[model samples]
Target: MAKSATLYRMATDEHICPFGLKSKDLLKRKGYELDDNLLTSREETDAFKNKHDVKTTPQTFIDNERIGGYDELRSYFNKSEAGQQGTTYTPVLAIFAVTLLMAFAFSYASNFALLSLNTAELFVALTMGVLAIQKLRDLFSFTNSFITYDLLAMKVVRYAYVYPFLEAFVSIGMIAALPAYTVAPISLFIGGVGAVSVIKAVYIDKRELKCACVGGDSNVPLGFVSLTENLFMIGAGVWMFIK
Candidate 1:
C-alpha cells in the first residue's frame, strides 16, 4: 500500500490558513497521498483544534501518527531552516539599480540619447548620494563602525563624522553638472583616502569587520563591495578630470 497522510486545516469564507496550503504542497511533493480535512467554518475549526489538543491549524498525520506543523514537516525531511541566512549585497544592489533607472529617466527627459556620458555621471553621483544618506541615517553609529577599520578615522576621529557630508557634496556637484575642475579633485582626494584605508584594513591587517559603506547597522562585510565603491569613485574622478 502507498504511504498516506492526513491534513486538518481551516478554510473559511473570510480566511484560509497559509501554512495549511504549504503543508499540503509538501505532502504532495513527497509522494504522499493526502487526505485533506478542511474545516469550512470558524466553529468547526475551533472544535477540531480543541479535539486534537492542538493550538494551531494545519496539523499533519502520517500513518495515524501526528507530524506537527510546517516547520516540523521540513525538519522531518532534514531541510535547512528557512530565513536564517546572513546579509549580503542586496542593499547596495538595490540602491545601484534605482540610481541606474533614475539616470536613464533623466537622460530621456533631457533629450539626450540613452547611455550618454551625462547619464553615466548622473548615475555615479546618485549612487554616492544614496550611500551617503544611508550613513547619515545614524551618523554616530556609522562613525563608530568606521573608526574600527578606516585608517584615517582611526588616527583622526573627526574625519569619520565628516566623510558622509563630503560624499554628499561631491555627489551634488556631479548631479548638477558643475565644473569638473573643482569636483574632480575633491572626489579623487576622498576616493584615494577611502581606497587606501580599506586596503590597509582588509588586505594588510586582515581584519574581519562590518563595512560602514551601507551604514553601521548593516551586515555587509568589509571586503569586495567596499573596495568596489572606493575604486568606482576613484575611477569616476579620474575620468572627469581628464575628460
Candidate 2:
C-alpha cells in the first residue's frame, strides 16, 4: 500500500491560507496521496484546532504520525528551512536586479539596443530612486540608523531625513533629462559627504554597524558595499557633467 498523508487547513472566501497551499504542494511533490480537509468556517476551524490540540492551521499527519507545521515538514524532508527573517543583502540585490532590467528596457526602447553608456546613467538614476524609496518606507528608523555612522547626519540630524528626498530629486531630475549643471553638483556634494562618512566609520573608527543604504531594516554591514554606493553616485555625477 502507498503511503498517505492527512492535512487539515483553512480555506474560506475571506482567507485561503498560503502555508496550507505550500504544505499541500510539498506533500504532492513528495508523492504522498493527501486526504485533505478544509476547515471552512471560524467555528469549524476552532473546533478542529481544539480536537487536535494544535494552535495553528495546516497540520499534517503521515502514517499516523503528526508532522507539525510547514517548517517541521521541511525538517522531515531535510529541506532548507523557510521563514527565518534576518538582515540580508536581499533588498539591495532585488533593487539592483530590477533597476538593471529597467535600464535595459529603457535602452532598448530608445536606441533599439540593449547596452550603451546611457544605460549606465539610467541604471544609476533608477538605483537611486529605488534606494530612496526604501529609505522613505520608514523614515524614522532609517534616520536613526543613518546617524549611527554618517558624519553629516550626526552633526546635523535633519540630513538623515533630507538624504532620501535629495536622492530622489537628483535621480528624478536625471531621468527627466534636466540640466546636468544643476543636479550634478548636488550629487557630488552628497556623494562626497557619504563616502567620507563611510570611510571614517568603517576604516578609521573601525565601528561595526549596519548600513542605512537599504534602510534601517537591512543587515548589510557598513563597509565596502556602502562605500561603493557613494562612489557610484560621485562617478555618475562626474560623468553627467563631463559627458
Candidate 3:
C-alpha cells in the first residue's frame, strides 16, 4: 500500500502560505497520497489552528500523527533545512558557475574566442565582484562571521568592513583593464591575508566554521572552497602584475 499523509495549509485571497506548497510538493515527491486541506478564509484558518492547538499553518500528518510544520516535516524525512542553514556549497558553486558562463559569453562576443586569457581574467573579476556584492548586502553580519576566521579582520576589525569594498574595487579595476600597478597590490594584500587566515583557521587550528566568503548569512563551510577563493585572488593578482 502507498504511504498516506494529510496537510492543512492556508490559502486566502490576500495570502497563501508558501510552506503549504512546499509540504504538498514534498509529499508528492515522497510518493505520499496527500489529502490537501486548504483553509481559504481567515476565520477558517484560525479555527483549524485553534482546533489543532498549533501556532502555525502548513501542518502535516503522517499515519494520522501530527508532524508539525515544514521544518518538522523535513526533519522527519531526514532532509536538510533549506537555505542559509547548516553547511552548503550551493551559493558559492552557483556564483562560480554563473560567472564562468558569463565570462565565456563575454569572451565569445568580444574576441570571437570562448577560451582565452581574457576569459580567465573576466571569470576571476566577475567572481570577485559578485562575492563582494554578497558581503555588501549584510556588512554587519558578514563582518561578525568574518572576524571569527579572517586574520586581518580579527586584528583590525575595520578591515572586515573595508574588505568587501576592496574586492569590489579590485574587480572593477580588473574588468576595466586598469593599469596593473593600480590594482595588483591591493589584490595581493587581501588575497595573501585571506589565504593565510583560511590555512590557520581550518588547517593549522583545525577549527570548523561557516565561511563568510559568499556573505555573512552563508552556510558555506570554511575549508577547501574558501581556500580556493583566496588562491584565485592571489593568482589573479600575480597574473595581472606579470602580464
Candidate 4:
C-alpha cells in the first residue's frame, strides 16, 4: 500500500502488491504499470504514509491524495470518478492458498507428530509447508535489524532477497543434519514454521486484515509484516526443494 502510493507520488507507475508481491504481479497482469516493492525502501515507505496520513494497513492513496482502502481500489479498477487507476487482486488468491495451506497442513502435521518421536520425519514436510506460506507472504523484514529510513534501497533489497534464502537453508541444514527427534532439527523447524504461520496469520488477520490468505484478502490484502514474517519460512521451503 505505502509502496504503491509512493510510486504514484513519484511517477504515474502503479505498483501492485499482493500483500506485496503476489498482489503486485496480479495488478500488472491486468495491465497496470507496476513495480515490485517486495524490497521497498524506508524512505518510500514513510513518505507514502506521511504524504497521506494513512492510519490503517493496506491504505490506498492516489496522486498524492488519500483514496481510502481496498473498496476504493476496487472502484478505481471499476473506473469510477472517485477512484484512481486500479488492478485486480487475483494474485492474492494464489498467495492466500499458499498461506492457508501451510497454516492447516503444518498445524495438523505438528499436532499428530506429537504422538511419536519416530514420526519426526514428518517435521520436514511441516516445516517446508510453513516455509511455503511464509515465502508467499514475504515478511522477511524481521530477519535483520529494524528497517529504518536511513537504510538505502540497495540495503533493503539485499536483505529481502538474501535473508529468506539463508534462513531456509539453515532450517533445511538443521533438519538434514540433526539426528535427534527429541530436539531434532526437523522437529524444530516444523514446530517453528507451524507455530509462526498460525500465530501470525491469525493475529494479523484478526487485527488488521479481514482476509485470511484467500480471495477474501483481495478485499484487503495481507499487510507487509505478515507477508514478511512468512517469507523466511517460504525460503525454508525453497531450501527443502533444493536439498
TM-score of each: 0.67, 0.91, 0.85, 0.25
In terms of lDDT, model 2 sits at 0.90
Query: Which residue pairs in candidate 1 have backbone atoms (N, alpha carbon, C) closer than 3 angstroms, thus clashing?
Result: none
Candidate 3 ranges beyond 4 A from true positions: 1-6, 27-36, 60-68, 71-85
Off by over 4 Å in 1: 1-84
Better of 3 and 4 by lDDT: 3
lDDT per residue (tens digit) for residues 1-243 in model 1: 888999998899999999999989989999999999999999998898888898888899997888888888888778766553676778888999999999999899999877788788888899999999999999998998999988888999999999999889889988776788878888888888889988988999999888999899888889888888888789878878777
Residue 68 accuracy (lDDT) in model 4: 57
Q: Estimate, for each residue in 71-111, the C-alpha lDDT of model 3 and write its tens digit.
A: 99999999987646667899999999999999999998897
Q: What is the model-wide C-alpha lDDT for candidate 3? A: 0.93
**Model 3 error, position 79 (Å):** 6.4
Q: What is the C-alpha RMSD of each candidate to the true structure, in Å?
A: 5.5, 1.9, 2.9, 15.7
Error of model 1, residue 138, in angstroms: 0.8
List lDDT for all candidates, in order.
Answer: 0.88, 0.90, 0.93, 0.42
Worst 10 residues of 2 by lDDT: 83-92
Is 3 or 4 the stronger prediction by TM-score?
Answer: 3
Two-way lDDT contest, 1 vs 2, winner: 2
Q: Candidate 2: where is the Cα deviation over 4 Å?
A: 84-87
> Candidate 4: which stretches are off by over 4 Å?
1-114, 118-121, 129-155, 179-243
Better of 1 and 2 by TM-score: 2
Of 1 and 3, which scores higher on lDDT? 3
